[model samples]
Target: MEHAAPQAWLLLALWLWPLLLMALAMRTQWRWLPALGALPALVSAALLPVGTQLSLPWLLLGTELELDSIGRVFVLFSALLWLIAGIFVATLMYREPIGSPSGSNHFAQRRFNALFLLAMSGQFWALVGVDLVSFYVGFAIMGLAAYGLILAYGDPAARRAGRLYLALTVAGEVALFAGLVSLAAHSGTLTPDPSLLAAAGGPSLALILLGLGVKAAIVPLHLWLPVTYTAAPIPATAVLSSAMIKVAVLGWLRWLPLGAVTWPHWALALSIIGLLSAFYALLIGLIQRDPKAVLAYSSISKMGFLLLLTGLMLGQPDLLGAGITAMLFYATHHALTKAGLFLGLGLYEQNTHQRRTQQLLLAGLIFLALALAAAPLTSGAAAKYLSKPLLQAAPWHWLSPLLWLMTLTTILLMARFLWLLRFPASKAGWEGTAAHPTESSAHFELNLLAPFLAWGLLLALIAALPWLFAPASFWPTNSANLLLALALCALVLILSKRGRNPLATLIGRIAPGDILGPLERSAQRLRTQAGRFQPGQRSTRSTESTRSTDPTSASETALELKLRGWPVAGALWLGLGMLLLLLLLAGAR
Candidate 1:
C-alpha cells in the first residue's frame, strides 16, 4: 500500500508537473520554463516500475493511469524528446529579445512556452492513460494545443496550415469519439482488455483506425503533415513528427485486437495500404525542396512501416509479443533520430555565418541521417534487426522483398533530405535571426552550448540504442542491403552531377500537400464559376435584408457563406455528420 501511494503520486506528477510549469511560464515568461516542465515526466518514466496503476474514481467517469510495458517505452522516449526540445526552446527564448515587461515579445514568448508545456502534459496524459475518456481528453488537448503552435507566427502560410490541421484534428477526434463510444457500449466497459478488444465490432475497429489514421499520417489523410511541418517552428515540428504522431500508433496498440483475433482480410488490406503508403510517400518526399517537408514525408513512410507490422500481427496472433517490442523499439529509434535531425537543422540554420559551427552541424546531421537510414551499427539497424524475426515469420513470401525496397527508399529519402538542407529557404521572423546585439558573450555561449548539449545527448542515445535493445549482433544481419542502397544513392548522385540534373526539375513540382494544392485551386475555380450564376450585388443585398429580420435565418446565411468559402470543408462535414448519425443509430438499435 505504501509503494502504491508513491507510484500513484509519481504517475500524477508525470503529467501535472508540466501543467504547473505552464501556469508559471504564463506569469514569469522564464526562458527555462519549458525545460523545467519536462523534468518530472523524464524522472517519472525512469523511476516508475511497470504495471504501476493510479485510479481516480472521481475523475472523468473513473479513469485509470498505468505504466505498462508499452507505456513505459513510450513515456521514456517521449519525455526525452520533449526535454531535448524544451532545451532548444530555452535557447530560442534566450536569443529573441523579450523586450519590456508588457511588450508583445514577452507575451509571445510566454504564450509559446505555455502551449509547448501544455502539449507536453497532454502527451504524457495520453501515453499513460488506460481508460477511454482519459485518453480521448489528452489526445484532444494535445491536438488543439498543436494547432496554436502551428499558428504561432500567424502569417498567411501558418494560418493556412493551422486551418487544415485543425480541421483534420477535429475530424479525427469525432471519429475516435464515436469509435470509443461503440467500443464501450459493446464491451460494457471503459477500460480495454484482450478479451474485450477481441469482441469489439467491425464498425468500431474501422472507425478507430480511421480516427487514428489521420494523426498517423496514413496516405490520403496525410495532407496536413508536410504543410504543418514546414509552417510550424522547428522545435514544434520536431515534437509533432517525433512524439505527437506516434500517439495514434499507441492508440492502435491499445484499441485493436492484434493478439486476440486473426482477421486475415483486415490484415491483408492494411498490409497492402501500408506498402502503398511507404512507396508513395517516398516518391513525394524525394521531390521536396524543403528539408522539413522531406522529413515530414519520411515520417509518413515510417508510420506506413509500422502499419505493415501491425497488419502482420493482426493476421498472426503468435507474433504479438515480438512484434510489439520491435515496433516500440523502432518508434523510439525513429523518434530520437528524427528529433535530433530537426534540432540539428535548426542549429545549422542559426549558425549559418559561423564556418566551424556550420561544419560541425552538417557532420552531426549526416550522422543522424545515416542512423535514420538504418546504416550498420546505428539504432535503425538495430530496430530492423529486431523486426527480422517478425518478417521471417510472416506467411506472405513477398513481404521481405518489399520491406527491403522500403529500406532502400528510406536511404534515398535521407540523402535527399541532407541535400535539401544545404539550401534552406530564407524566412522572416525569429526563425531566421540570432541573438540580440546587446546580449553578453556568456549568455550567447550558454544558449549555443545548451542546444548542442541536448542534441549531442540525443545523438549518443541513438548510437547506444542498438547495444541497449538488440539481442546478439549490433550489426545489421542484412549488411548487403545497406551496401546496395548506398551504392544506388552514390550512382544517382554521380549521374545527376554528370547530367543536366533531372532531379532538379522535379523539385517543387508537387507542393508540400501534394493533392491539396490542386484541390484548393479547383475549388476556387468552381466557386468563381458559381458566383457568376448567383444574384447581382443589389439583388443579394435585398435578399439578405429580407432575411436579416429573422435571427435564425441571418445565422444560417452566415453559416452558408462560410461553408461555401471552404468547398472541401462542407463535403467533409456532411460526410462526418452522416457517419456519426449512423453510428448513433446503430448504438441505439
Candidate 2:
C-alpha cells in the first residue's frame, strides 16, 4: 500500500509533545508526564503505519513521519526499550528515595524526566529524519543529552568516561558528515535512496564506514566503550547500549548504497574486520573485572558479527534481505539483554546481601547472554542459525571454519562475561570503594526478571514460528551450538575457583592503541618544531639580524621595477584600444 503524505506539524508535534510535556512538568512539578508522553509515540508508531505520511510545505523546515517495514522495526525496538527503561527509572525514583541509607544517591524525578524527554525527542527525530540535516540534528541532540545520564554523578571515573565518550562521539559525527556530503554530491539529490548507496564505491563508502565504525565500536575503533560502559550511570548506560548503538547500526543500514554494485575488496575487508573484532574484543573482554565493561566488549564483539553479516549480504541480495531481517531481530534481543544486565549490576551494588530472587535474575541474564551470543531458540540463536544458511550460499565456503571459530570465541567470551558477573557481585571483587554490599535490590530484580520472562517467551515463539513464515531449509546443521553454550556455562560453574585468584584490573595494564604514548610523542615533536620556527623569539631574531647585515646596494637593485614609467603604461593602454578598434573594423567589414 502507498503511504499518504503526513502533515509536517504532526511530525513536529511528535517531538513537540515531549518538549511541551517537559515544559509543563517543569512548571507543575509533575515528574511522570514525560514518561507518560513517551507512550503516545508508541501509539503513533502503531497507528501511523507505512501508508501514513505527511508533508508541510509552509514550514521553513519540512517534516515527515511514516512507517515502512524497516522503519517499523527500528521505531518499535527503540520505543519498547525506552518504555522499559522509563518504567525502571520510575520505580527507582519512587522506591530508592532521594538518598538511601547506603549513601548511593537517587535522582529527582524532574531532573531525570527532562533528560529522558530530551533523549526521546532526539530518538523520535532521528527516525523520522528523511533529510540529512534533520537526521544529524536528531543524532547530535541524542548524543549530548545522553552525556547527562553518563556523568550524572561527578565521580572521577564518570568524568574520565564522559571525556572519552565525547571525544569518540565527535570523531564519529565528523567522519559521518563527510560521507553524508559525498553521498549527496554523487546522488545529486537531497532525498536519499537507501539502495542507491550500493553504487557508492570509494571515499563515500570509507567515510560512512569509518564514521559508523567508530560508533559501532568496530574492533580498533572501539577504545571508549569499556570505560564508559563501566562508569556511566545505570539509566545512561542502558540507553547507550540499547538505543544509541542501534542508531549507528541503523545509519549504516540506511546510509550505505546496498543496492549498488558490490565491491569485493571492501566486502572481504569488512568481513575480516568483523571476524578480527569479534575475536579481539573477546580476548580483551575476558580479562576485565567490571561486569559492565565485559558487556561493553560483548556488545562490540556481537556487532562485529552483525557487520559481517551485513557485508556478506552484498553477494546475495535475496539472502541479504533475510540476513537483515534476522539482524534486526537480533539487535532487539541484544538491547533488552544488555540493558537488563546493566540494571542488574546497579541493583546488586545497592545492598550488601541480596535475599531477593537473584536466581531468576541470573537466569534472565543467561538467556540475554545467549540471545546476544546467538544461542538457539532465542532470537539471537535463530539469528545465528539463519546466518549460517545465508553464508553457505556465499562464495567463501572456506571461511565457515573461521566463522565457527568466531562463534566459539563468542561462547568463550560469554563464559568469561558470566564469570565477570559473579566476581563483581561477590565480596572478593574489585571495589572502587573498599566497602560495598555485594547484594542487589528487589526492585532491580523485578525490573530485570520481567524482561527475561518476556524474552524467554519470545524465544520459545521464535523456535516455533519459523514454520509459519519461512519454510525450513534442507541442511544437516552443526547441532553443537547449544551444547557448546551450555558446556561453557558448566565450565564457568565448575571453575568459579577463579574467585580466589587476584581479580583482573578494570583499567587496561596495556591500553590498546597506545593512545597516550602517541599523543605524547606527537606533542614533543610539535614543541621541537615550534622552537625552531619561533617567529619573534631568539631563532627569528638571529635570522632577521643575518638578513639585515646584507648590502643596501644589493637590496636597492633587487627592489627596482623594470617597467615603472607612465609612458609605457599609456602605450599599453593605447595598444589595448588599437586591438579593440581592429576587432570592431573587422566586424564592420
Candidate 3:
C-alpha cells in the first residue's frame, strides 16, 4: 500500500494536470497539447491499485480519495472517453474555419479545451474521491463546466440548451447538497462515508435520488438530454452521454449504502420509476428523426435499466455483490457501445462523396448497432448475462418478462436510429463546407479510418471484458437468451418492413421528449395568460395575437387572464418538496 502511494499521487496529478494545461492553452499557441491532456489520467487509472488512498488535509477541510474497485473501473473508462473526445476535438479544430476577430481559431480552440479539461478533471476527481464532500465538489465542478461545452457554438439553440442544462444542474446540486448536509448532521460527522452511516431514512434517500436523477436523465427528469445533445458538438455529445451521465450512477453507488441496510419502499419506488423511464424513452425514441436525438433517448432508456438494477439491489440486499458487478459490466458495455454509435455519426457525416466509403461506414454502423442491441458474442450479451441473476431472484421474477420487453424495445429503437442516420438533419450553414469534395481519396480514407479504428479498438476491448473479468463458462448459457431476443427483434423488423406494424402511427406521432413537450406547452400557456392580466391592460382580449372572430378563444383568454395571478410554477415546486417529505415520513414508519 505504501509503494502504491506514488501511483495515487499520479491520480491527483491526473486531474490537476488538466487545469495546468488549461491555463497554458490560454497563453500558448500549441493546440496539440490539449489532445494529450487526458493521457496522464488514463495512465494513472491503469497503474493505480484498488485500495490506493490520498488525503488532502489542506484542501476543503481535509478530504480523502481512493481507487476502490468501482472507482478504478470508472476512472479507466472515463479517461478513455476523455482521451478519445480530446483527439476528435483536436482534429476537428484543424478542419473548422477560424472564428471572428481577425480570423483566429485560437480563441475558439482555447475556450473549448479549457472547459473540456475542467470538466474532465472534475469527472476524474469525483470518481476518485471517497468522502461525500469531495465527491460533491467534483460533481458540482463537472456539472458547471459542462455548460460551456454545450454553448460552444453560441447558436440560439445551443444557448437555450445551455440555459436549461444550467437550471437543472443548479436544482440538482441544491437537492444533493441539502441531502449531504442532512446526512452528515444525522451521522454526527462532517465527512461521513457511505459505509459509516446506517440505512438512511426516506427523506435523505429521496433527496439524493432526486438530485442525481436529474443528472442521470431519468424519465421525467430527462428533457434536457435530447435538446442539449442534439445541439452540442459530436465530441461533446459522446462524452456527455457516455461518460458524464454515468457519474450519477457512481454517486448513487457510493452515497447510498446498498448492502448496509434495506429499505424496500425506496427500492420499489425506484424500480417503478426506472421501468417507466425505460418504456417512455423507448416509445418516444422510436419517433425521433434526428440521429443525435435518437441516441440521446437511447441513453435515457439505458440509464433507466441501470436504475432498475439499482432498485433490485436495494430490494434484495443479499444480492449486492453480484448486483454491483453486473452494474459495472453493464455501464462499461453501454459506455463503449453508445460512444461508438455517437462517434460513428461523425464518420458518416464526414464521408459524403465516395459510395464505397459510405457503404463501409454503414456496415460499421450496423455492427455497432448490433453490439448495442446485445447480439450474442458481444459485450452487451456478456453484461446481460451478468445481470440475469437479478431477475432470477425472488420477488424480482416478474422483471424477467419486463427485461425481455425492454430489450425488444431497445432493438426497435436501434432500428429507428439506423433509419434516422440514413437521413440526418442537414448541417444548415456548413452544408457545402462540411466535406471537401475535391479532397484526395487517400486523405478521406485516412480520416475515416481513424474514427473506425477507435471504434474497433473499443468494441474489441468490450468483447474481451467478459473473459478478463467473468468466468469463461458463462457465455454458453447466455447465448440462448440472446438468440431469443434477436428473434423477437427480427419479427418486429419484418412486420415494420411490410408496413403491417400497428405501433408505427404511435411512433410517428409521439415526439422524442414525450411527456415534456406537453408540459412545456402548458407552461407557455401559463406565461401568456400571466402577461394578459397586467394592471391597466386592454380589456378587449388583446386581439393582437388572437382573432376577434372566435368567441370561445376570447372567452378562454379572458378566463386565463382572470386567473393569471396564480403562482402555478412556484406552487408546483413547493408541492413537490412536500410530497417528498411525506414519502420520507411514510418510509420511516
In candidate 3, the residue pairs with backbone N, CA or C atoms under 3 Å apart (3 or more residues apart, or in different chains) clash, namely none
Ranking by TM-score: 1, 3, 2
lDDT of each residue in 1-589, candidate 3, tens digit only: 3344556687678888887887786667565665677888788788876888887754564567788899888988988988877777766544562344354556766767777888888888899887777788789889988987898777898987888898999999999988887787777665565565554466876788899999999978898898898888888888999999999999878888688777687788889899999888887787666778888888998899899889888888899989999999889889877887887778677777766666767777787787777766667777878887875783856777887778877876777677666644232210112232333463445644555677667666766766787665565644555566567657755775576655555544545556657878999999778768877666455656555668888898887766542245325644875786576556535
lDDT of 1 by residue, 1-589 (tens): 2245665678888888998998798789678888887787788888888888888765666769898889988999998899888888888545753434344467767778888998888989999999997898789878878887887766788989999999999999999989998999999998979779889879998999999999998998999999999998888999999998899989989999989989999899888888888899999998877888889899999999899889988988988999999999989998888899889989887775666667678889999998888888888888888888788888898988888888888988888787666644222100112222222232225568888988988888888888877876867565787788779767766665575455656777898999999999999999877866777634556767878798989899888878744235535754885786576556545
Q: Candidate 2 at 589: error in angstroms?
A: 49
Candidate 3's TM-score: 0.84
Instruction: Indicate which candidate wins on TM-score.
Output: 1
Best by lDDT: 1
RMSD per model, one decimal: 6.8, 14.2, 9.2
Q: Write the per-residue lDDT of candidate 2 for residues 480-543, one digit (tens) a residue.
A: 8657767765654544455433433333443433243466579899987998888765675785
Total clashing pairs in model 1: 0
Error of 1 at 176 (Å): 0.5
- TM-scores of the candidates are 0.87, 0.75, 0.84
- Superposition error at 133 for model 2 (Å): 2.2
Off by over 4 Å in 1: 1-3, 97-104, 423-444, 537-589
Candidate 2 or 3, higher TM-score? 3
Write down the lDDT that model 3 would get.
Answer: 0.76
Q: Scored by CA lDDT, what does every candidate get?
A: 0.83, 0.64, 0.76
Candidate 2 positional error at 265, Å: 2.0
